[model samples]
Target: MLLALRALLPFSLALLFGCSSTETDTSTEGAAAGIALTETGAHAVTRSKVPFLWREQAYDASLHDSISIITIDQKLAEELTDAERAALGYVTTFIGSECDWDGKANPEFSNLKCKTLSALKLGYQCSIEHLGFLQHWFRNDQEVLIQLASCPRIPFTASSQQTFDEIYLTTQGDTINVWFSASGVNLPMNATWEWTEENIFLAQDDAISLVRTNKSEVIRSELKFDEGL
Candidate 1:
């Protein structure tokens, strides 16, 4: 009987180990489905969970006045964690605007518009006419690159039109950089000649400094990020 018990012990242990292994694999597979990691390894995680928070303060070198723009784009009402939603409550008073963050029935574009205008402070006359396409290119888990093909522009008046302005960003990891570019057609001749690129690098404490690629050009501005972004 002692010999039979010893022989059964090994089989029992093996069965237990097999069951544990299967359970582990099942759990891992379930997690993988939610995370949805691609084989290419470029995007370690999708943007659905992560909060896209950033504020950009751009200075007009010619006018010498800086504009503070805070953007919170995502399905914030639906996707934000309880903690994140609570964070919004703290800032509602300071944001100086009311928004009906109705993510359930709202489409992606309308949701973005509501999130942007509600969370950020803008002048009474200025209103963002449109929110353009947002493309997120993630290099890894720690790094995310975003390109705004047509950033929203607030026309001064109802009849006024806004030209297309493209912006790019590298958010996450250690350093973040942003670039703004725009072009327009010359009147009469109708030739598009002026296409400019203004690059800004992240500075200390929610600020960005102009990166002067041309040694001769004295173009500089201290673009700052808004708080609570």
Candidate 2:
């Protein structure tokens, strides 16, 4: 199950957000306002009309490892796309989690300790791991960015195993480009699935186009955003 989901990741990431756009001179003002709120110890409210209803797929591959042609699950895509469409706003917040490590701790692999165990355990170390979340605010027509954010916290879940972080969005004329970068440790049976360093760009227009690269391989896919269930 984990392996299959990881296999679907590249395609899943591409299809996740490929719908709609916005235009306004106030866009910069809106972006700055959101940033200010974050700086002032508050979360920014995101508003847009691009119903999160985005569903599409592209070929998944890897240049650093073996490659295969895979498409994301259609039913799963429709469900998620519809859910996103219903969601109208997003904000950012941080919560705590648990992460444990032995020897020299790798910040990326483990940093939060959700258990009662002390960080100075006999042969291990632990700490309160803070994770980020997106809060839904009000709705409007200003552009905002959504990144992969965090890596998988639970090994058993499909989301944790195959996801992106730091998704950034920008616009050029009539095109909205979504870019995201991520890094993670390798998992069993998930060689090409684990990315040492990867970046992806989703170019949106009448149709959706993608360009993704990591370590050595590059993937490209063409898709269309479906607004209906």
Candidate 3:
């Protein structure tokens, strides 16, 4: 069975949810409901059985605030067991202004677990707006997966566009694995996805694309996954 679930906030609502250095409440007791503040005050998570957490700080002067999933839980990154790290999936730090393409200065520590979808490249700027995450768990198997994606604004010949990076995590028995993918294609702001048992159908404007869940491959087509649409 396809047990799919996702979390998102409309652009307008997401903007209201955006946090800044000065506006954030540093106290753990004052955090929003269902959210817990990390010891360092750099991250927060939903207080539930399967918690969903995110970076709270946008820029870390010492770190230059580059984009990364490994640093999401900085304190725990070093403390987590290999198996625990894998189960957590690819945790990303808060979106900041800079992008570390070479991974030299600001390396994403768990690179082996955080595999990319396409050749990494430079872009204009990262967007914190509409940043979202999704989680999926198999009923019959001892496996769970989560994806954290962000759309960044990229300059195009005719206009600017939004691109995404798909970060995923999966667990099996005592082992866990993490994966990352970049949507090399530029898409409109309204792009959306439909999940099926084996594939994800992406729709934007009048075009549709199919993403194979197993191989992490994409197939573009002018027709919709469901012809009726």
Candidate 1, residue 119: how far the Cα is off, in Å:
8.3
Better of 2 and 3 by TM-score: 3
Error of 3 at 99 (Å): 6.2
Consecutive 10-residue window with the lowest summed lDDT within model 2: 88-97
Output the lDDT of residue 111, model 1. 36
Query: Model 2, 1-229: lDDT tens per residue?
Result: 7456554443333343222132222233444333211122111222231121122233334423332222222222232221121121121111111222333336564633322112112111111222111112111212221321332233212343333323333332223333333323223333323222322322222222224434533232333333641
lDDT, model 2, position 174: 24
Minimal lDDT window, size 10, model 1? 132-141
Clashes of each: 0, 16, 3
TM-score per candidate, chains pooled = 0.26, 0.23, 0.25
Best by TM-score: 1
Candidate 2 shows a clash count of 16
Model 3, TM vs. native: 0.25
**How good is model 1 by TM-score?**
0.26
* Best-to-worst TM-score order: 1, 3, 2
Q: Write the per-residue lDDT of candidate 3 for residues 24-129, one digit (tens) a residue.
A: 2223233223234344311122222211223232443443432222123233334333223323322222222123233322332222112111111111122221
Per-residue CA lDDT of model 1 for 82-157, tens digit only, reads 2222223222211212123233324333332233334332211112222110111111212111212223322211
